[model samples]
Structures are given as C-alpha cells and as structure tokens.
Target: MGYDIMKNNNTKRLAVSLLLIFPLLVFGQKRVEAKADRLFQKRAYALAADEYEDLLKHNWNTAYAHKQLAFCYFETREFDKALPHLQEVLGNDDLPLRYIWEYALLLKAEGKIEESEKWLAYSKMIKLKNPLIPRLSQDSTWHPVALLERQEYKVEPVSFNSKYSDFGARIYNDTLYFTSSRKTPENNSNYSWYDEPYLDLYYIPLSSLDQTPKALEGGIRSKYHESSPTFFKDYKGKNSVFFTRNNLKSGQYVVGKKRINNLKIYKGEQKKNGTWDMSRDLAINSPDYSNAHPF
Candidate 1:
C-alpha cells in the first residue's frame, strides 16, 4: 500500500510540473515573437522571418506567427510565399492593420485586382491606423499599392537638412513642421560613430498658389534634438506644436509634448517672462517602447 501511494504521489507531482512548464513555454514563445517583431523593425526581414517560422513550428501563436512571416516575405518581395499567410491573417476577425497594404499589394501582383481594391478600400475605411501606411505610400515602390487613382498627389518636394532620417510631416495654418538631424555642438557631436547629425525640428511657411515653403521664425532653430515634429490644429482653438526628442533619456525613447526651447516634449505655454510653465510629460509614450516614427 505504501509503495502504491508513493507512486501515485510521484505521478501527481509530474503532472503539476508539466502544467507549470506549459505556461513558461508559452511565455518563451511570446518573447520570441517580440524579438522577431524588433528584427522586422530593424529591417532584418530574413532573420525575422526565420524567428517567426520557428515560433510557428512549435504551434504557438499561429495567427501572429503567420502574420509576421507574411510581412517578412512581403518585405523581401517573396510574394508567392506570402499569400497563404496573408490569407490566414485576413480570414481572422481580428486582422491587424499592419499588413493590409502589403496584402493588397500582393493581391494586385497576383492579378487579383478587384480583391486588392477591396482590401485597399477596407484599409482606407479604417483610416489605415497601422501608422506604416503613410510611410509605405510615400515610397515610390509601394505607391501603386495605395490604389489611389491620382497620378499626382499635389505634393511638392519640400527640402530640409538632407541628412535627417525618418522625417515626419504635418500641415498646420498652411505651414509644415518637420524634423532634421543636421549638426549641433551638444547632441550633434554624439553622432561620432554614425555620420548623421542629431535631429531637430524645423518649419517652413507655405505659399498660396504653388504651395512653396519658406523657413518660419526667420529660420529659427530649436536648441534641442527634435525629430518627428508635428503641429496639431484640432477642431477646437488649441493650436500647438509637438516634437520627439531622442536625447531625452540616453537617445533611444521619445516623448511628445508642447515645444519648449529644449527637445523634451512637455505641456506648457510661454509666460510673460518668456519662460515655459505648466509643463507635463506625454502620457501615451512608454519608456521601454520608444515611439519612433509617429503618425
């Protein structure tokens, strides 16, 4: 009886151990998925695809695995292999906006023009919330995927510091606010390894007919490393300028807020003494997840 009881207790312990191990295994798979996502962001599409495929091999997070794999294939222009994965993503009700444009482009490439159009329409209906759509549309290669009939988008080549990486644009009061990593003594010198200078916000006024732009504030440059600058003019009377700073906390994460003399994003208005007051941090941004390339 004692031997039988001991054997039964051993079996119960083994079952419990397996149950605990299962969750840990699931968490490990999620970490792999996150790493794959980061690899994709860094433009290492081939490596990301391999990691995504590895996650799928374990039958873990199949939906997301397929979706990310499709992105990798699409990036490398392996459209033939991308179709089934894209199809699986679309078949699910919780389809992410991340790959809608790519999927549409793939459909069009495969001679499924009508289906591609439908996906494009659907993407537009949702306002293409993935934040990657505008960047993709701006690329000459992916313009056809946007499905916009107009050959010309009425866009003029607005120039800035030629070295700025990942420039963002916003139109307000017929003016454009953009970011550029030109050169500076403080933040600019930090780019010793990389040739590009630190990024800062700049703006230009618009003309009436041709829509040409000239520098605002007499080409006044900010004193901070500002990139991804945007001007928000909402339905209300709130007119504010915003930008993201890389050097805020060691140059990886970005924070958004009202423009001060510095690159930090905070909420405040210029006081009568010419100093900012009531400054606050943007609640939406995360420390771990730097909001690079805002829409």
Candidate 2:
C-alpha cells in the first residue's frame, strides 16, 4: 500500500512540474521579442522581422505583435505581411492613430476601396491639435484621394505646343493668365532651361460667347518658370496676383506678387532688367514637397 501511494505522488508531482515549465517557455519567447524590438529601433527591419517570427511561434499576443511586425515589414517593403497586420488592426478599432492612416493608405493602394474608406472614417476621428490636418487636402499624399471625390468634375481637354507641363488656371476680369514652357529666340540652341525665352508666361483673353467659353492669347510675358498662380482678393475690393518663380541658379522656387492691369497671362522669365524681385515661395509650402498646384 505504501508503494502504491508513492507512485501516485510522483505522478502528481510530474504534472505540476510540466505546468510550471510551460509558462516559462512562454515567457522565454519574450526575450526573442525584446531582441526583435531592439533591432527594429535600430532600423534593421529585416533582422527584426526574423526575430519576430520566432516570437510569433509562441503565439504571444498575436494581434499587437502582428501589428508591430507589420510595421517592420512595411519599413522593409515587405508589403504582404504588413497588410495582414493592418487588416487585423482595421477589424479592431482601438488601433493607434499613426498606424491607422498607414494602414488605410496601404489598403487604398491595394485597391481595397471599401475597406480603406472604412478605416479612413475611423482615422478622421483622431484629430491633430495642429490646424494642418485640414490643410493636408492640398498635399500630394492626399491628392489622389481628393481626385477620387471629384467624380462630377467637368473635364475639358486643352493642349498647347510648349513643353510647359505644370499648369494652373485662373479667371479674372474677363482675362486668363497662364504659365507655359516655350523657348525665347535669344536662347541658345543648347539653351539653359531657365534662361530660355520659352520659359516666359503667356495669356489669352475671354470674349463674349452666348454660352461657350473661349480662351484667347495676350502677347505679354515673364522670363522664368512662373508656375503656380493664385488670386488674392483683399477685404477692400482690390485684387492682386501671387505666383511662384523658379530661380535658375539656386534651383529653388519662390513666391512673389505683381500688379497686372489687363489680367493677361504671363509665363515666368528673368526680365532684361533682372527684376526677379517680384516673386517668393510661400511659407506654407513644404520645401521637400512641392506646392505647385493652384486652385
């Protein structure tokens, strides 16, 4: 009888030992995860991801783990893994805001329109303290999304012979001013791109039409890359022109103002008098990202 009791006691002790060992195994996985996090902080995303995979084998808080793992995947351009993590976060709304936008954009890029829109709705709930979030509509990252909403925009096909690609249109006082890329006669055959006469501005006049709008040209011009144009209507009823000029030497674009009587179009150019004093770049524009489009 005593022998039987000793055998039973041994069996019970073995079971308890296995239970304690199992938890330690789980805790040991965290060491691998910690190493991965360190690698991620150092921007060694690929190595971090490898360690994360080992940690994932232990099934450690998969939802959050996958989300973080996905970020590393994204940083390394391993988009496939990043996607599932993003999907997980999308299904769970409590995700951090920074990750929400990242995931939404990734979904949008993948052509998952419905899903992306759903996430974007949630992203809108996270308001930044700075006033710039609303202003992001004008940013390039949002441009494609903004284009999606303009489904009802009237399309007009207008083309010109000059190489002028960046275009903005403004209508004022029965006239139109626009920038174009055309070389001047004085410019060399191997012309400096900026100094060429073709780099000047051009415009057209709008005359009476019963219904149709017609664009007619005025000959006056500027000599630089005068690209974006905006009309500022002051409170006192006086309107002024604001535009950007690309400096040839510095390779920097600047914004400036000019007084125009006819509202005629002018392409930017360095005048014979070197009066580039009329332009400067606005502070609102990011130096890294161009603010070329005018609305």
Candidate 3:
C-alpha cells in the first residue's frame, strides 16, 4: 500500500513538472509559419521577415506568406526586398486595396513611373471613397517638389520632461496630463515592441510649470500601459475622463499565442473628493482592436 502511494505521488510530481514546462516546449516547437505570424502580429516586422524568408527557403510558398513577407519588408522600408513579393501578390485576384496602394507607392519610389501609374489607377478605382487616392491618381507624376514657403515656430521642452519617452500631452482646465514611461518599481515590465517601461498617466498644474509631475491617484495607473487621457463633458454634464489601457481579464492582462495586449478605452469620473472613480471599460472597446487617442 505504501509503495502504491509513493508511486502515485511521483506521477503527480511528473505531471506538475510537465504542466509547468508545456508552454515553453510548445513555444520552442512552434513552426516557422506560426513564429512568423506571431512576430508579425506583435509588430516585430524585421524578425518576422527573417522567419518568412525561412519559410520560403523550405518551399512553404503560399500567396498569404508572400503577402505577409512583402508587408513586413514594406513596413521596415526595405523597398527593394518588398518589390518582388508585392508584384507576386498583385497577381492574385483577392488582394486588399491597401496592398495595391502600397505596391503603387513602392513602384513610384523605385522610379517605375509607368507601372506605378497603372497600380495607382487600379487602387484609386477600387477605393473611390478615399480622398487621397483621387489626389494620387490626378498627380501621377511622382517627383520631389520643394515647398515654396516653410512655416517655422519656436518650441521648447517642458520643465518636467524626463529622460524617458514623454508625449501625448493634453490639457483639461488648468491641469496638464501626458503619457510617460519613467522607471518605477511598480512599472518595471518593459514593452517588447519599444523596449521601454510601460507608459503611465502623469499630470501637473499648467499654472505651475515648475512643479514636478505626479502620477494620477485613485488606482488609475496599472502595471501595463495607460495613456492618451482626454477630458470632456459627458451626457450627465459631469467632468468625464477617457484614457487608453490594456484589456484585462480576470484581473490579469490577457497575453498568449495569437493573443496581444490590445488597448481599450476606460472611462473615469471626477468625484467630489477630487479623486477619479474609474468605471469598467467603455462599450466601444474591444479586445480584438486597439481604441486609443480619445478626443
């Protein structure tokens, strides 16, 4: 009986070990296609291009792979590398309008004027509602034209600007709110795409520019990103705030294979106590799409 109990315990231990290591093993065993897709979704276009090329080397040539490879090269501005794949995908009947538009731009960049004009005309015809397409179609001659007049203005950096990325400044009444990725013990995790600390909402009094900025109170900041705060009068006529944050599920940010840290719009109300009472995510937010830069 004791021997049987000991064997059962050993089996449980082994099962636990496998459970712990399963994700890593799966990630390690991911195919080139899967890895390339994930990297593309994560906006790691350079790495994704390499994996896509690996797929091509293994004769995994498909329309989708070629299109994705072209997109990756296009995003990285490797126009020469992107040209052939773009041409390949353009031959397909079900090509998206954006791809055609990009291919047209690439042709123009490469000085293939006649070919570029053809693709540009096709793209314009496919997307008639897009105003830019009409302009491009009209102006088929692609050449750098110097601006006759330039407007220059003096700009100065804010006093509270830190060494880290500080941007997306907005003003509400006399308060100035902006996003920053300053290092803090609570926000130590680095954003993979930018290699920077997670952004947080910080504010200072516009009247008192010399004052140091402070992170907003009332649990407004999280371990993940919180940015682009916009204040407006809601239907209730109360001062309401809207900001962008990563979608959280079960008190944790959802992240895994084919899953990304998508941004959502969160609403907050200024309470009588001067602290914000943040509500759940707005109905407009979706885990699949990023909703940011609220006006």
Listed per candidate, the RMSD to the true structure in angstroms reads: 12.3, 15.8, 12.5
Best by TM-score: 3
Candidate 2: tens digits of C-alpha lDDT, residues 1-295? 9999999999999999999998898678777878878877655676777777776677776776777777877775556678877776666656666666666666666666677666565556655233433344233256343344344568765554444332466766675656555544532232121222433444555553233222221212234345555655545544444555443324433333421111112222233452223433355654233345455
| TM-score, prediction 3 | 0.55
Q: Which stretches of candidate 2 lie over 4 Å from their true place?
A: 1-7, 91-94, 126-295
- What candidate 1 gets wrong by more than 4 Å, as runs, is 1-7, 91-98, 121-295
Clashing pairs in 1: 181-198, 181-199, 267-280
Give the better candidate number (1 or 3) by TM-score. Answer: 3
Each prediction's whole-model lDDT (CA): 0.60, 0.54, 0.77
| Model 1 lDDT tens row, 1-295 | 9999999999999999999999999899989989888877766677788888989899988988898888778766567878889988886667767677778776666656678778767887766566555454444255554444335567555444353453576776776666655554434543321235655554566554344233223112334345554555435545544445542543244333422123344333334443323234477654444444445
Steric clashes per prediction: 3, 29, 0
TM-scores for all candidates: the values are 0.40, 0.42, 0.55
Candidate 3 per-residue lDDT, tens place, 62-113, comes to: 6777999889887765677888898889878788777787777766656676
Ten-residue stretch with the least lDDT total in model 2: 259-268
Looking at model 1, residue 236 earns an lDDT score of 51
